[model samples]
Target: MSLPDALAASILSDRQLRPEFEAICDCGGRLAGTPSERRALGLVARLGEAATGQPAMRIPTPYEGWSAQEAALHLLGDDEEVELACYPLLRSVPTPPRGIEAEVVAVGRGTEAEFAALAPELAGRIALVRHEYMFAAGHLHRRLKYEWAKRAGAVGFLIAGPLPTRAVAGSSGRGHEDGIPALGISPEAAARLARTATGHARARIRIATEERPETTETILFDVPGGGPEIVVLSAHIDGHDPAESAIDNASGVAVMLAVARALAPHAGQFRRSLRVAIFSAEEWALTGSRIYLDTLPADERGRMALNVNLDSVAGSPNLTALCSGFPRVAELVEAATREAGIPVGTFLPLMANSDHANFAAHGIPALRLVAGFDDPASHCRHVLTAADTRDKVAETELRAAAIAAAAVTWRALTSTDSLR
Candidate 1:
């Protein structure tokens, strides 16, 4: 059956999505194991019950939890010292209680070859690199740069953001044992840390954090249909520790909740059941989704027809479905959106940047709907920073994404061809 126009219209009202979005935003950045993340789980469960007519099930998932208490970076010049604005990378190790001092070295973009060129004199020095535009192609991830610097024997790491005065935020993909003291610094800081006529300058970094095994909950709602097959509409509920995390994910969760409410009426008539998997700790390298998917048995995993992941879906008005190189998935989305009178774009290459990659890795067809695919100047540039707040997205843009998502999900579940 085709998606009813009435159902589409029902989701248009901002009354539901806006408050839900704000509530999630008010919960702070929702970093894993934080009070904010815990509050979000309860709020989402209430929203899920209102949408699905049944209480959402909380699935306990375990992961290593990391949180920062305080972090500071300063450039120690011969005569005058200046403090730099910065944010610590997730899971970074703390420096000595008093901090560590070392000579600073700039490795440009910190690519493999860049590190190789400076390999001769990198030991015991602090490596400085630049963060790239996340939504663009060929953009080097911050983790790769940290690994390269670690291999080159750097004692500490610093990454500069694209925007000046705003220190870029990202994960070092490091643990207390495997990582050096890593922090994200502003471009201005990078400039000051540059070598002067007096040669390389010294820097000091101090960090205080707590690390241990912790458990977070994954909220799940299963609306059963006649068949055994399932279509998973998924999104990550947690985001960076800074800002409202609006563009990075509050937008996605808001869209998912609205869509879930729209589809609940047609629960058993569709060709397949809809399973809502609202996950957490996505900013921590997709840990929540990975653990949940890994727990499914072979037979249950095979029952998963598709995973439609919504993440960072409203930083811009334009939306693109990253289909991970699956031509059939792209075709399905295009046809559905066209049928709905919405012109949504599609990118065929597979990107492991979000939770969808976990599903696709398990051999299930998965695609991530995102905004500002290659547009660098879009509001997505604010993601992972303090600027990813509620104002970055518009109600119209979110409604458009919901329409596109609903159209594609309806087509995927009701199509007779049996999605490849």
Candidate 2:
């Protein structure tokens, strides 16, 4: 079979793609700014170039270096042990504990007005906040709440999790240099603690960390000879600690590799160039993509036809297409999926929390293709945890997603008219 036909066949053959997924999963947690992430970048650069027969480059990015000297949390009474979940604000506090403990107060929903109302009462207290509706509109609200909580003189804050449906737990206060130590508690644990704090409970938290500002890079690979315009394919090659981020994004990288390989033979046939970007620090607020947008020349930026982003693609039963404001791109994506016999549908505007956000922010047309939002059992659970390993991904789903993505991307890249 030809390359495209072989790609289709291999994608349909479940066992054929397991090795690639396994390789990605084996890389362990590739959190942004970590050595593992750099290694993963190199791996993708090599694999992508080999697959596409095109040159690839590694671009540097700006990142603040951080190191945890000591981090611990425990309830004072009855020696109740509380789990230590990383908070974005904790990086700003002083090293270790300074013998500071305040009364534990429930901040209700921790909204802006709610926080303003309770600001006086929250002064000098450790706030135990609930994440009931925080993730509803993405982490923007949650991040604002954290800032509010910190500004209210709350020495520390604890967030209750298992966020809303289709929402994954994340921290946005990473860049805060003067923030409090925030931690996420399981729902059951948080409920128990909240109930026990009728009068006042004590939380002894300590975090010893170091912060340094530095520059990082985001690599963009361009395959010439297709066309004058370009179709951007993006994936972040970063992972967190402990777990090998096979599903969180390595799946996306693997799919990009597969697509690059499939497109190699027909590199000169398409009417547009293929720009594959391995973005950096996506986990740290889409930093790399934003920088990339800023550096793009005005004329070149306008020439971008469309951005096809692949984040989490393996392990879901149904595929979802998240379209920006443009209706034509959405229609074309739907048509392409239908042509490929792939089950796809429109998903709610979940906010471009990934690399696509930067492009969308600049009014560039973009789409986020994902699978498994409806699958209750399959979600981005081990995202930042040590459990996000390769074993969590399904080879079959990864291959299928890659194939569908290539088909859609190829069609979009070769269309007579520009998608932009």
Candidate 3:
């Protein structure tokens, strides 16, 4: 089916996506529980209302919050000692004022097997590992590595970035007690601390942080159709602060807004209503979506036909739908994207990388629309680092993703069998 002319025009005239993206970046990186996140929330509400022609609904979501006040790494080798730049992973446990000094053990990729192989050597040591591309096949999540490190008796964890200059940033899964102190170091910094046969190098990691209970909202806007079922268009609003978090999520949100504006006018004739969920604290282990899903009544949960979750939708021109084992959703997405003249890849297995996993956990058919999957060359490689800025995403890339998303969302809204 060809794209509707009206929707096409709306998409063409859309200068809003770029500006909205820039606006989000200007909010200073929407780290959860920070003023930046609050500002981003207000922006989303304003933009969502303008796009959907209605007031946005605010659903309060609460969680224990953690923030880093200061973090640093000091290398102490036989002949040299120098301080290095470091970013503490979100929710990482703080070090004492003087910090802990331990021998460094390079753990390679920090996988379960890697940690196990080095288990004996890890005790009282700081385990260092390379940060793999998040979208690459067989990628081990950093959270699990943190868990593995803790279990291996490592006193601290260090993840070296793929890029050369800046340190990487990610969640530490250290929100609970018994979590280890974790920090992200740049490639250069990691190189300096590398262990040689001459001696086992020792280093000190110092981190200062504060903890509190915080509350934020999941922004939602409802666009009606005649059917009893709803199609959820979700994207997380919060992201890491080290970068613009542009590729990680700001792009997903812009695409959602574009789809909302283009779909809102003709929604009355469709088969399902559109429910836009802009979740917060997503970088904190998909917390916002988890809470939102848990509170839904059983009947309400049953009323959802599909979740078209857009996360990092345009770090590259190519897109992949992480289908989460929902074959029907995958087929529908492929058909719509092809019909819209957009190329997209489909990965069938379920992944818990984004907010979509929360919906899938409840037996709801969900698919994550992401820009990069197997392509290590994709802009996703730059995500979670200071290099993930707006320039990494081209306008054409965002447009193609927007068109494909609009097509798929349009079909889901109009189709009689959304997930069948």
Number of the top candidate by lDDT?
Answer: 3
lDDT of 2 by residue, 328-404 (tens): 77777777877777756765464656777678777778887776655545645445444556766767678778877
Tens-digit lDDT string for candidate 1 (1-420): 455788778877647887888888888888789888888888888988888776788999999988899899999977987899999999999888999999999999889999999987789999999888887667788888999999999999999987758887878886445789999998899999999898897899999988889999889999887688899999998877768888879899989988888888877567888898899988888889999999978898898888899999998988889997778889888988877767678988788899999998998898999999898899988998888999999888888898889888887677545555
**Whole-model Cα lDDT per candidate?**
0.87, 0.68, 0.88
What local lDDT does model 1 show for residue 237? 87
1 against 3, candidate with superior TM-score? 3
Q: Model 2, residue 385: displacement in angstroms? A: 3.2
TM-score of 2: 0.86
> lDDT of candidate 3 vs native?
0.88
Rate residue 17 of model 2 by lDDT: 55
Give the better candidate number (1 or 3) by lDDT. 3
Candidate order, lDDT descending: 3, 1, 2
* lDDT (tens digit, per residue) of candidate 3 on 1-420: 446867867886788988888888788779999899999999999999999987899988999888899998999866887998789999999899999999899998888998999999999999999899998668889999999999999999999998988899999876567788899999998888888878667999999989999999999999888888999998998988887888878999988998888888887778888998899999998899999999999999999998999999887777899989989989988898887778578888999999999999999999999887788888789999998888898877777888888888888888878583
Candidate 2: C-alpha RMSD after superposition: 3.8
Candidate 2: residue 75 Cα off by (Å): 0.4
